[model samples]
Target: MGPLQIKNILQTSPENQSVTVKGWVRTKRESKNAIFIALNDGSTIHNIQAVAEPGQFSAELLSTVTTGSCLKITGQLVESQGSGQAVEVKIDDILVYGTADPESFPLQPKKHSLEFLREIAHLRPRTNTFSAILRIRHALAFAVHQYFNDGGFFYLHTPVITASDAEGAGEMFRVTTLDLNKLPRTEEGAINFKEDFFGREANLTVSGQLEGELGAMALSKIYTFGPTFRAENSNTTRHLAEFWMIEPEMAFFELEDNMNLAEDFVKKVITYALIHCKDDLNFLQNRLAEEDKNKPQNERSIPLLEKLSFVVDNPFERLTYTEAIEILLKSKPHKEKKFQYPVGWGIDLSSEHERYLVEKHFKKPVILTNYPKEIKSFYMKLDEDGKTVRAMDVLFPGIGEIIGGSQREEDYDKLLGRVKEVGIDPENLWWYLETRKFGTAPHSGFGLGFERLVLFVTGMSNIRDVIPFPRYPKSAEF
Candidate 1:
């Protein structure tokens, strides 16, 4: 058989069986008679101990087996005499595949600051914290597809380059092949997009929701999980220039259906992580506890595992935006002017407002619906009062708005009017408008930032840490 992964080796019974394990050396200790090497293959958070007699290997070879060195070790598996671990390997043969110079290697079995890790993102995955986080991230991603597949939702691939601005926010990365040095110009002296690659202005899509809605119209249920881009220059903990999104659109679903689906989806995935990624989650929970110890008692976050359990066990509180506003107005923080931004009916709710509802007031996940039309996207179904739209936002404790979605307006005239009001040319979105004109159905969908979900589950403070390579303002290093 091929070399077994460390994860499996650590779980097997010691029958004095000979096995070969290949992994990087995490730590090495030398003593008078024996050498102990802690090795990890990134199969799991735990490392396997490999014990070697002083004369088992050449002195030069043993000296090169420092931290971060790659090795292929053949040994007899036996019950460990160590206090913490259950099993260990008694090395019979060893080969050095590669060596990391301990004098210059960055990770040396020491605690590292998150900011410093960001600089060495390419190497951070070798660390325990990142390896555990990456494992949980994989679990969560698998759970997302599995849940949708079990629910009969078709996975649709949408175009990354689109002309239509889904959010109408004008914050998009322009896609062009035209030479900037000598750009073609129209008679009006404007940079002519007519000579561009797609024969018009094109950009990286801000969402797949619009295309997802098209699939849902015919397929009944559809979902999209892919990269989306934004050109916003904001440098904050919550912002990323490029990130992954999970969008699920369903036909014949109203506002209540949308809210219910979002809640169940979130709870199901978090539960999956709890069950499948127990070891990784336990590591993260401990890490979060250490982080919380430094903050003031009142400012510290709830324990990671407990917070996740709370979300899964309890039903999310559902309330309308108007009702949410009234509650906020009566809140002690509002009266004391503790919020950085003022809260009112027409204004869009900020992260501070969302956390107040989830962390302080409701003390659970919250689904706030029926936001004012001005603050929501144009496709949301406008209420009969013509003031609000059927929009919903899912709020979590540490992270604010984890999901945003709405029931779409099936009325073509209203959608067209809103498109005009939002300053988008009707001709640009003619195909989208045609859908509303032809076979329109009551549909709803929501967007979940994939990194944000990982951040919450991993108990990570910065959104940058959860994702493998973070893309942000003026920084695109791999």
Candidate 2:
């Protein structure tokens, strides 16, 4: 009786039963006897073919059925005579809801570069690549919640505005309502924050981990999935000014338990995409293959589907940061001077080094633990060795660090000392310090960059392509 989605129509048996379909026209092919239209409603990547006889509609009406036109059609579902698809619709009547002028429409039935699509992000979702990617992203996100919920983790909503910088990187976007042109000066001629909204310096949160810890301390297990901001000016393909992060904090968990949870979580989300988003994944796999054909044989990657399967089927290799450093120091890349960044005991691992470990050396997902305390965040629990902290980073083949977390320092004195050692004011974090002072338990958690996961799963080269509206340095255009 009512309009049915194109995806549902494509899946049903062709019984010549009349049905109503509403969607945007993807393409139109004109033949001597009829016009064949490909309609897609964004419910699925596949399109439904609708056949219209020459006498069924006027030339004026058919002329408007170009790409991007929205239409509602009443038709009888019948077996298609085509090779690729199984069913199609024989149109009885058509109504043109809206028409897109071919002369001005940017998305034609042709191949467009990813760079060009980035410029018109608002309309890129209609394209097959982006549509498929968005579907997979949705499936992965759903799986994240399902996995955590099944594991008895409560979803925690953390504040977007706060005075504390959890990462201590100082790359924060200041949130202020004070008039810059007005005078609010102190005796020392410093800008007085007493006139500000929060009555103190506030910033867009760089992470929700600190707040998540507060919830985990009471709830035992909690996770936060929310937008995070960073003021870093880097405009690399892997960087974003604003992005989503998945952070899960668990109480009474050690470094080893943390590592296990991270590995299982990643694998579960990937497996979900494989099962639920098979059609979209197949399209993306073919898309990546076609793109790879342009690259040199040595630079080209394996099939996208195979890469995903490898992650789902295989066990991630686990090792200590010390062992990983040893392996890298003695690696062929290091010995032959191929590494751009020097690798050693205290040096932080670069993207190149991380990729080498996962793609070439280990040839699997790697969980590297026990990082040097100086290179890691101050909140990370320091090991008995007094040198390394209980930090862990999960590295994938193409994407370096997909997840980073640590067992939080629970001892009040140790945490306070480390906070001061890192040049962060302990008094500013009095509330956080009180958590340790009152009833602190050993807790562990990790933050996974959601866009990076989508990028990796979709086989997309640029991080900008995965998110719908990308925010970056000097670029926030809708």
lDDT of 1 by residue, 299-365 (tens): 8888899999989998999999999999999999999999899989998999999999998899999
Per-residue lDDT, model 1, residue 438, is 90
Per-residue alpha-carbon lDDT of candidate 2 for residues 344-381, written as tens digits (9 for 90 to 100): 89999999999999999988989999999999999999
TM-score for each candidate, following the candidate numbering: 0.99, 0.98
lDDT of each: 0.94, 0.93
Error (Å) of candidate 1 at residue 63 is 1.8
Candidate 1 residue 327 Cα shift, in angstroms, is: 0.5
- The residue ranges of model 2 lying beyond 4 angstroms of the native Cα positions read none
Compute the lDDT for candidate 1: 0.94
Q: Residue 5 CA error for candidate 1 (Å)?
A: 1.1
